[model samples]
Target: MRWPFRIAMSTTAVMLFDQAVFAGQFLAGTFGALHTHRANATYSGIAVLVAAAAAVPLRWPGRGPLWPVLACLGLFGLIALQIVLGFQRLLTVHVPLGVAIIGLAAGLAVWSWRPDRVAA
Candidate 1:
């Protein structure tokens, strides 16, 4: 159980970070949006580090709570949607999905450290 969950969580976190990094590269080299893209990459990097921290104990016998895992799942889903929308240019500026992603990532990271954390 721990192994499976840890693998899933780690994979998702890496995916999240990878997606953001790709977006940054695209923005900087192709789209000429270096500053904004760099910021995005930074956020994604932070998310990765936080997620990694959470995953640390998950590899052990007694690990994280449910909310953190849920948060990661939710955040990953939303980010996947956002990534798809990016390809379609369907993401609107007024929409704050990016901010939401960051918030969820931060939330999940913090929640993962909670003593009573459980899997759902």
Candidate 2:
């Protein structure tokens, strides 16, 4: 659980950092530079999400096992779809979904590492 939490936390942090960078790239009007960071954050986010999903069944301190796993899967699916929407240049969907991901990932990471959750 700790390991998974750490991975999830790291990915969220990556997203947070990249978002700022993305904004900078946008402001600078260098769309090309954004891709590398975008790719890095997305790919790494997916990988860490997988790791956290795998950990869900191992020893999740939470009362229900499936909820955590499902949550991870749900977020994973959303992010996977988000990538597709991005490549297709669907800002209508992509930008909002990215915001969702940032919030969800950050929320989960904070929740996971909370002292109370770990104590349980």
Candidate 3:
């Protein structure tokens, strides 16, 4: 697998795991909206970082780690949307959007698994 895609997968997994842990506390209302906002900020920051770091690697002379980078970027956008939805208390949009992102990320990971698609 490409190193960049591996990184993407690992990062995504970490993000999910972190969110899961955060959810427990979030449900408990450990810090109220502060925890919620912090989680959103963290996700947005990660997406920006992932997109920047993967840009060159996914578009250079190599075949490109196209799917991983795109997936991360897409997720980043969705995360931003989620924050807005959360702020508006739009539970319907927020939940579905989050699911969509995870689904897309999984699809990207599968697509990136192809031998010729991922950067080395």
Candidate 4:
């Protein structure tokens, strides 16, 4: 369960990083990059969803702490909202939210791999 969760979280984190890259390219005056960014945003959301699903078993059957499950779900919700904001051209909120999302995803991915955190 822990391995699955870790893998999913890591994947999600990477996807989020890719999102940032695409966004940067878009902002750098590459019109085509905007399309890539939009597509990657949806993919990143799906990755977050997969990570959240993987986290479920960590809390059930007394396998591990519940925080990861909650965190993943919260992150997914934020991503969903971020997608909406992006499509509506709301950069004021979207930019800050994206930064926060990347940070949170990275943190969760690192936490998932901590040796002491895994259940025996």
lDDT of candidate 1 over 1-119, digit per residue (tens): 34443444554445444545556676567564545554554455455545545555554545434454456545656755665666566748313676566555545544433455446
Candidate 3: global Cα-lDDT?
A: 0.60
In order, candidate lDDTs are 0.52, 0.66, 0.60, 0.89
Model 2 over residues 51-79: C-alpha lDDT tens digits?
56655744555443455566667777877
TM-score result, candidate 3: 0.66
lDDT of 1 at 10: 51
Cα deviation in Å at residue 114, candidate 4?
0.3
Best by lDDT: 4
- Candidate 2: RMSD to truth: 3.3
Residues forming the 10-long window of minimal summed lDDT in candidate 1: 109-118
Q: Pairs clashing in candidate 2?
A: none
Task: For candidate 4, write residues 1-120 as lDDT tens digits.
Answer: 689889999999998988889888878998898899898888888888888888888779646778888898899899999999998999999999999999999999999998855345
TM-score, candidate number 2: 0.72
Q: Flag the better candidate by TM-score, 2 or 4.
A: 4
RMSD of each: 7.6, 3.3, 3.9, 1.8
Q: Candidates' TM-scores?
A: 0.47, 0.72, 0.66, 0.91
**lDDT of model 3 at residue 19?**
54
RMSD of 3: 3.9
